[model samples]
Target: MSAITAAEGNPQIEFWFEFASTYSYLAVMRIEAAAQAAGVDVVWKPFLLGPVFLSLGWNDSPFNIYPPKGRYMWRDLARLAARYGLPFRMPSQFPRNGLLAARVALVGVAEGWVAAFSRAAMLASFAEDRDIADDAVIGELLAALGLPAPEVLARAQAAENKQALRAQTERAAEIGLFGAPSFRVGEELFWGNDRLEDALAWARAGP
Candidate 1:
């Protein structure tokens, strides 16, 4: 049973991520390959930190509301990105609205392109410093993926899809998630870009 579980089990880890999150950008860039090499399946879970912040009595990204932490965050991201051989750039906008991107990512998850689309969205926002909030950016990303942007956008806006995203956010909260780039392996949770390997190891080791 243990061998079978390791070979054909459910998602070994649930990747809880938010687009506006800096650390999430790092994790997103590397998680797919790491998980594949570990022979662990991942469930990509997109969520909003807005509600989570509100629940904590904050109205915005803690990074912006607290400048010192924000400064450290940017510097830290630069160092980490360099170590990973990935590009990094500070966006003109901090925490750009990710609602549209998240919704489309939900579609990506269903259509089997969420990983690529998520990476592209992250690159647009962090590496290229583009405004992901704009529908045009997401449209271009969809078209690049050979998906019909208009139709995908339409489905993304459907009431059911909207509600599904909300439910995923709520689930994140229920799972005790407090930030992006969090990983859940069975009942164990690990957070931060630095913990990506740890999470994979834990998942690969099984419960």
Candidate 2:
């Protein structure tokens, strides 16, 4: 869904993530530092998993539709979060709307602040249990980054930005992405937070 490649000779990996994805929180918080250590570049791809799930004949997160799966997933997520030493709090609302935040992220991508914005947004929803769908919350995120909230928000909400996000999501589906926190090195796709280190290793090794 997104890619961040560095200059020639530097290895890079595409980081595909959705804001509502629980595991993505772990990946998003961890990728930057890990990539830095591996000397690899990361591309932040923010895409909507709703449409992808719909394509698979599912209207909601698999965790929500199946009770047992949902229970196991929450426990697994908590354990993993602790293992990584990242904070995790179950949000009252599962899978909060990320449309607005994703759009704003496209603007941040252009302005070179996507990473900081993404981390803040994730922490807001996953750590603080904030309603990320709220425009005010996103606005606060941008302003906190020293970005001009009104101006940037205006750009993010523009018709063109909306179209861009749509295109990005469509591309995600086209590229065979069925989930978030996926990593791509060339044609290879590695899914899940656990595979993150492997993805970075793949990029670091080069072709």
Candidate 3:
């Protein structure tokens, strides 16, 4: 599965991402193509980093907590975005709440539209300055995908779906995940957008 297509018997890597993450935006935009090029399948994993931060005793994004780091991060992201030839725009908000978007993404993951939906959502969050947490915004995103917005929203809000997101977040912590855009090949975890290639190579080379 190169993000959307299920290619059985191919090497696979789990892409654990948080929608609020800056690097995740970049990775989501490119992962499908990269995975296809490497002949690897991608398992899209949408998770929340809020609980993960709490586990580290932090109440907010590390970027928000450390001004210096935040500054460097934005600059680096800009540079990389330029190098990658993707649009670069500083979002009006830092780390827009992505809980609802992630929930919808989980649904997309199951429905085989995860890659397309993820790219659209990431653009809304990082490029369009949309409030990802808003129900209206999510509905629009779904509608854009030709899906029944109301129905999908209701399903995403179901008790079981909410609980599933929570469980995935907990699993993130269980697997030693502290950040987004993480790639897991078997038990070997590679963190960062830059390590995506390494992760794909590892998968292509096998366990």
Which candidate has the highest lDDT of all?
A: 3
| Model 2 Cα lDDT, one tens digit per residue, 1-207 | 133333454688999898999998899899999999998888888889999999999999999999999999899999998998988899999989988888988888888898899999999999899998998999899889999999988998899999999999999999999998899999999999999999999888854
Tell me the deviation in Å of residue 179 in model 1: 0.5
Off by over 4 Å in 3: 1-8
For model 2, the superposed segments whose C-alpha errors exceed 4 Å read 1-6
The Cα local distance difference test for each model comes to: 0.91, 0.90, 0.91
lDDT, candidate 2, residue 157? 89
TM-score of each: 0.94, 0.95, 0.94
| TM value for model 3 | 0.94
| lDDT measured at residue 86 in model 3 versus the true structure, 0 to 100 | 81
| Least accurate 10 contiguous residues by lDDT in model 1 | 4-13
Show model 1 residue runs off by greater than 4 Å: 1-11
Worst ten in a row by lDDT for model 3: 1-10
What is the C-alpha lDDT profile of model 3 across 1-207, one tens digit per residue?
454455456789999999999999999998999999998889999999999999999899999999999999999999988988888679898878999999999988888888988898888888788888999998998899999999988988999989999999999999999999899999999999999999999998954
